[model samples]
Target: MSSRYAFTKTVKELRSFLTRAYPIMKKNNPHVPILIREGTGALPRVYARYDLGQEQTCSLEGLSDKQIEETVTSLVKPTSL
Candidate 1:
C-alpha cells in the first residue's frame, strides 16, 4: 500500500470508530498520512492507497468500533511477510 489512507463519515453509527481509530492509526503509523471526509452521505468505507496508483476499498457499514479499528490497523500496519 501507499503511504496514505482515507475514511468516509456519513452515518452517525461510524462516529465513534472514526474518532478513535483515526488518531490511533495516525500515531501507530506516523509515516502514513490519514485523511477523513465528512458529510458525503456515502456508505461508510475505508480506503487504502497502494503503489502504481492502485487502491483498495472496504465497506464498514455494519462494523462496530472495535471491528473498524482492527480493519484500519491491519491496513495501515500490515504484517511483514
Candidate 2:
C-alpha cells in the first residue's frame, strides 16, 4: 500500500501546498529549478536545486501563497554576504 492512501490528509495538505507554491516559487527564482517535496512536518518542504543537483530545503508551513512568495524569495537568495 502507498503512503498516499494511508495518509490521505497529508496528501491533501501536500497537494494544496504545491498548487499554491509552484507559481510563486517559479516567479521568484526563475533561474534555477524549484522543488516541493514531502517532509516530516505538516507542510511540504521546498527546495532549490543547484546545477550539480545539490538541494537545500526550506519550510513554508502555514504560510499563505503571498507569504510563500515572500519567503521563497529569501530562500533562493545568495547565501553569502
Candidate 3:
C-alpha cells in the first residue's frame, strides 16, 4: 500500500501519503471516524478507522452534499503543529 503512494522509502513519506488519502475517504464517507496510527501518543502516524454505525448514519441521515464535502475536505487537509 505504501509503495503505491511512493511512501515506501520512509515513515515521513508514508504519513504524507496517508494524510493525502484521508480526505478522499472522508469525502466519500463523512460520518466514519478516521484513526491515525502513531508511536504511543507523542508521535503520530496516518491510519484509517471505520465504524459501521457512522457509515449507516452518513448514508441514511439528511446531510447536505455541500456539508459532507466540506467535512471530508477538512479531514484530509494537514493540521498545524
Candidate 4:
C-alpha cells in the first residue's frame, strides 16, 4: 500500500476509535480537554493532546492492532485518582 493510503487509513481508524472513546474520556476527565491530531508518518502517526499543554504522540506504529488499541486507550485515558 502507498504511504499516503496507510497514513489516511490509520488516521481514519483512529478518528473512529476516538469518537467512541470521547464520552468515556469526558466522563473521566471532564475538566480536561482531549484532542487527537495526525502526526507526520506513513503509518499511524497519531498524537493525543490532553488538557491544554500535555501532548502524547502515539508510539504504537508497526505494532499489532491489539497493541495499538491498548496504547491509544492508555494514552488518551487519564490515570485513576
Model 3 Cα lDDT, one tens digit per residue, 15-61: 55456666777798698766654443232222322334322112212
Candidate 2, residue 27: CA error in Å? 8.0
Stretches off by above 4 angstroms in model 3 are 1-9, 40-81
Candidate achieving the largest TM-score: 1
The lDDT of each candidate is 0.67, 0.61, 0.44, 0.64
Name the best candidate (by lDDT).
1
Candidate 4 on 17-75: residue-level lDDT in tens? 66776788789879976555555754555577656587667655545555667886777
By TM-score, rank the candidates, best first: 1, 4, 2, 3
lDDT of 2 by residue, 1-81 (tens): 565553565456556656877787679758765544455534555666655667677765555556656666786677742
Candidate 3 yields a Cα-based lDDT of 0.44
Task: Give every collision pair in model 2.
Answer: none
Weakest ten-residue segment in model 3 by summed lDDT: 53-62
Q: Candidate 2, which ten residues in sequence have the lowest lDDT sum?
A: 34-43
Residue 69, candidate 1: Cα error in Å is 1.6
* Greater-TM-score candidate between 1 and 2: 1
For every model shown, what is its TM-score relative to the native structure? 0.65, 0.44, 0.34, 0.54
